[model samples]
Target: MPNSKPRANSLIELHKPKRASSVALVVPLKDASRECLKRLARYECPSLPPYPKSQAAAVLVGLFVGRWGDIYVLLSRRSATLSSYAGDTALPGGRWDKTDASLEDTAASFAETARFIQIGLPIDKRRVPLLCTLPPFLARSHLIVTPVVVLVTDPTLRPILNAPEVDTLFSHPLASFLHDRAPFPLPSSSPYHDMPWGPTRVRLHSFLTGREASGTKPIAGLTASILLEVAQIGYGIAPEGFEADAPGQASRRERIAWELSRAERFVEALKREGIRYDWTKEERREREKRLGRDKSRL
Candidate 1:
């Protein structure tokens, strides 16, 4: 009866992600690949060893699209002038600082994703998301590092590097690492001699990207292992370190505990050396407190 007709109903539709097209695709097989990484099952690394509490670190697993709709991962060559790991290829990340809230924050800062967006890359900024955090891996420097995975929704983004920490940036397709063959006649010596549990042998896979040669140094250490886990999810392959009909594999909690036990041994060694680490001592106190509480409750 009112002068104006009844207001039209506002339709509410459930949010459904659409697949990205070839033109200006931010990442290859966008929606499907993202969902695969998001819902990835546990990665099995039965032989992965624990790390010490004295050093904590984080690295960013930043992914984007290449010219031909292939997915590429951002990697950096560390600056030659650095005190450690100079001129080595690595993910853009560093030691966890006091200002950071978590390892995730450390990765986000190093990636500079926001700066890339502000520079006018054609992408839906809101579409970017943290896929998931992978379990901690032991670095060659005796630092325990957690890999923080992030999706970059801009194909044309160029990451800004900190000259002291990072020298240059490069990318490689993820498919190349899906299945890797052991290098011919492994090197006699590696810097990972300090690795917990007697220096386990990790398979190193080599691949070429951009203008680099196939003979380029293969990504090794924790970096290689982390990529292998991600490749497993992207390609829908079975987790590494597991054989068909193997008796059993380590659970997520068990894997974490393994690292903690190794950390305790590191603490003992540090005490013997008369070296004091504030973080390690703090963690030990906290662990003791938790154990006391558990015993009281029991």
Candidate 2:
């Protein structure tokens, strides 16, 4: 029989991307702290109207990239049947439990859940160091979400997913997110005027870039707020504008450029009205067609 350690190493070796100037960062568990939980607990809700309060935890899982010289975040589409935030793109995490001792414990629980869904890659838990936690974000359902940032090493630990909670998992390269062409403009009719961009995208944007949006949308709410904190820690600057074209619109540079120019003003219009969106709900619904599962647990 093959040696387990050697076999594991071999499997890891197969998926490792070639060395570049920027490599994915992995922090050791010993260096990780659960202090972010305190900030999460104390975070004040954004200016939006308040809702009932519940507590939840999520992990801002990231990988180091050689080309971008920074960490990239991992995002996933939630199953449509969940009680809340159905079919939205988000980080992996769920409600806190009474048995959990701390945010780290809650994170571990999700990691295990990821494993159960077969999305748990053999992450070197020890090497994945905890960075910091963002302030808690308030969801529409009043779920106060605590986001924990962790750096992962070991390229061999490819994601294995459970289809029920996660429809698909994708990585947003820091470079792409930081690229000038990547920002999405806010719409005018959005319900979240103070935060033109919805919370999740805003959080992802903020984590990728440090600065917050200059417009009325202040990157409020749970996901966006947490992303803002992550961006501050990582890049220290936010991208100036939305991506030039719809994510899947066209591959041509000219087309992308035209779309970006048009989107800049449209985004402003959205900001004026407090609408924050890149794609319409219809777009999200259409994408759901490609995702196989419909049911999820809260």
Candidate 3:
């Protein structure tokens, strides 16, 4: 009798990957990619390509076209073993080392980042061009994460998880972030205002994804925010329900400036607010616990 066994890659095989047939089919994606580049170019100034006062970081936003003309973006769940931002969805880059002779050399150092994202796909440089970058975001760890968008035209690609840095690799519809209702199959919601970062807050989104029934943790926080801007520009539309920024919210550049210029004052205020210099999110946890306790009164 012949043995009948399921393949080890059975889970990945279950979901049909979206692919493009020809150049004509990818026009929507190409057009959107061009739109992102054009919109970002408008903000070009001397102060741009914002390098953080803290350690410089970056996240690669990989965009590609699917079969039916929808734009998709690459995302990954951070490894559970990670010390920070673990379980959250994220882009495929990280804190780039800035210890170099010149800013140009610093850019050269980022060539090393390919090692971080060199998963089983065997990315071809000809097909994947590192193109425009979106505005920088100031992370809780004090790193200024520049959002770099890249267009992937190659359809003959399959990605495997780069364990340690990533737990699972997934793709989400890039344009869906601009929609009021998230087009995810799994349960999803927008702007879950659970926590406030110091005095400011950003629009947070969450989606349940992956093969599991319960769903992954969430695509919330910085990752979601980055995609929102991408979708807004890429599709030339604003998010439906909520405004992008709250009133009096300090821009990421402004926040970074304050952090750098008033290092002593910032540290003291953060410490008083339980945002330790070590960057522990103590206030967030405490707020959750307090909310839980308050619910008991009802």
Candidate of highest lDDT: 3
* Residues 1-298, model 1: lDDT tens digits: 0122222111111011332222233233444344344453223323333333346676777765444444568777767888876776677666666676654455445333333321222234233444456767655565667776656664445555667666667777665555333332223333123222321223333333333353335566567667767766655766332221112223333334434445665556456545554543444554565556657767
Q: Rank the candidates by TM-score, best first.
A: 3, 1, 2
lDDT of 3 at 48: 39
Better of 1 and 3 by TM-score: 3
Task: Indicate the worst ten consecutive residues by lDDT in candidate 1.
Answer: 7-16
Model 3 TM-score, 2 decimals: 0.67
- On TM-score, the leading prediction is 3
Per-candidate alpha-carbon RMSD to the true structure:
12.5, 18.6, 12.8
Which of 1 and 3 is ahead in lDDT? 3
> Distance (Å) between predicted and true CA of 146, model 3?
0.9
Candidate 1: residue 183 lDDT (0-100): 30
Off by over 4 Å in 2: 1-54, 66-68, 102-118, 121-123, 175-192, 195-221, 238-298
All candidates' TM-scores? 0.57, 0.47, 0.67
Candidate 2 has what TM-score?
0.47
